[model samples]
Target: MAGTLKVGLIGCGNVVDYGHRPALLALKDVELVALADITPARRLIGKAWFRLRERQLYADYRQLLALPEVEAVVVAVPQKFRPRIVLDAFAAGKHVLSEKPLSNVPAVAAQLVAAARHSGLQLAMTHNYHFLPEYQKLKQLLSQGLIGAVRVLTLHFLGVIDYPGAAEYQADWRHTLAAGGGVLMDMIHAVYLAEWLAGAPAQQVMAFVDALQYAGREPVIEDLALLQIAFPRAYAAIHMGWGAGVGGLDISGSDGHIRLRYKQHQSGGFNQPIELYSVDSDWRRSDHAIPNLDTHEANIARSFTQLWADFRDAIREGRAPIAPAAAGARALEIVLGAYASAVCGRVISLPLAAADPVYQKGIAGIAELEAWAGSKTKAAGLFGLRA
Candidate 1:
């Protein structure tokens, strides 16, 4: 509505404080107009931290959206509530930038996409890992045919879901499936990366999910999931867990191979390093580790800032957002397909229908797991096996 993009942020949670707030503040073209959270303390904290006028704080998101000055809304709420907020923001004639795993469920994600499309508003899902320097370099290499024809992508991302020093309250919400807890949500970066590298649609998926070991706390969701996705051109595998472990991604192609290794911690500081092996005169290897580089955290912030800028540009230009709502819906579909395959003991095809038994069973299983996990005190391992 004005020369500067007026941004209203919803959900002043850990992510908002650590990631989005600083990044948005750094962007010159954007103004942080308002903030909304269910908790009064969080709203107060954000207002104090950002030095916003008292009137800019609201307890309800609907009230935030009703503000004429708020041209765009960033839905950084928990994954379970993302779909509703995204749809509502679009309906309110505001562009939306949502945190990852667009929705906890696929069906709701699809509805949100449809609503955004019909309303002709921007909807962007923040998958920040793709913007990392290493990833960007890898993409450039692949596009330039340095890796030749991509044949396989393997990603192993594992870390302790409940580590020491983490807030007890944070664990409470994360341990529940209703709050979108799982290796699925935690390790979704790998899934999206694999799909991005493969440059092909995921055709089918087969997954084995279990509630393996946790850090002395019951996980209301599957802590470990091994997913095998068959894309049109290449096959991919993702091994994700929430226990003591180390993980990375390996991409093998016709002529070269690249590996990115890191210790998985949810917050940041897991840059790891990238190793490349290429066929030249002889097989040569090189490591491109930046000196004292905190690429992971920097990339996360940069991705959000760039994503917000792109949303504003799209709106001003009357064009679709960089990662449109449909793409977000498709990403959720791919994730749901993996879950369905794990539940039904079969490969689930793409474009899943509403009447599919696997989808029904998947939802039921998630619900049951959540209920069972909440009542247990000890860390519940994978649903079917050890992590």
Candidate 2:
């Protein structure tokens, strides 16, 4: 590693534009050497934003990777294409940073993780929430035992989305099943926070899924779901939805409990702290203050700075990243388990076997809903959704 590693970034989508690009540009230790995006407009946008020359802008990522001066790569591409891109970056001897769901296919993601470990290159995931001040404060409080021995984790994530209607085909790829889009796409983050707070692996998962507004339209992916995960020493329930509901988290411990929330709108943006409460009944009740912000996307850029710093330090000091490939792989595996549970119509024990159909077929477990549907039309709505 040199004093300043030259960076080549792929994907100029929303995340790269608002989250990573700003963070990378602000870092003093690295040069933004190259950028790649399929969209010509986006390529020009990055070229102008970072002041890169036309020769440094590329339509094909491989051309960017060919740069001998490039020492690392940031991959914010779609979940499906990441395996190939990340693997290519590693083959090109570049340290990698990737945006999550690691892979829509767990098996392929596992391979990517293995490559990072065996290749001796750092692989960082953009799970920036873990780096947020509020979450950092929560982690600190837990370490101090403000709430002792957390046993239950509950998260309610509610947001609104217009039904795809006749324009389903033209909707954001996140709304499509083939792209691994669904209410649970961010379920991995909730699962990560739960495990981080609880200190255990989710041993099992059981879930129910619904497309709701698209009930009779045979949605390619669900927009609603409830995931129940059992840990070795505790349990977690995650309710994810695309329509009206409250959003928050509750953590219950042997001695006390903590509650946290946010208000999300298209305009004001995310993580606008609603409240944080803790009470033990014997001890004093505490109310912690949260941020008042203009946009959640702003904090995304802020937290990403910490995430990128973690990546840089890991590469510099030869340590694992704050959010490593294994952590992402574990979270991804649990999410897939919930999908399998929905299809199998039963509790799914985790450490899902390599041979599990979902491992290779990705969300292919959803297909089983067809056979499982039988004469149970209502049941089919859970997965084998019909018109």
lDDT of 1 by residue, 227-277 (tens): 898998899988877754666667888887776665332212254454433
Q: Residue-wise lDDT of candidate 2 within 1-387, one digit each (tens)?
A: 569868998987767767787788889997889999877878887888898899999999999998999988999877878889999999998999988888888788889989998899988887877876567767777788888888888877655343332221233676566667576774456778777877877789888766675667667777777889999988999877776466778888888988877755211124566667888847578987654333566676878887888888888899998889888888887887777776666888887788777776677555644334422323545334453
User: TM-scores for all candidates?
Assistant: 0.86, 0.90
Model 2 residue 263 CA deviation (Å) reads: 3.4
**Model 1 ranges off by over 4 Å:** 160-171, 215-218, 263-269, 274-282, 286-295, 357-362, 365-387
Q: Could you tell me which 10 consecutive residues in candidate 1 have the lowest summed lDDT?
A: 370-379
lDDT of each: 0.69, 0.75
Which 10-residue window in model 2 sums to the lowest lDDT?
162-171
Number of clashes in every candidate structure?
9, 1
lDDT of 1: 0.69
Model 1's TM-score against the true structure = 0.86
Residue 56 displacement (Å), model 2 = 1.1
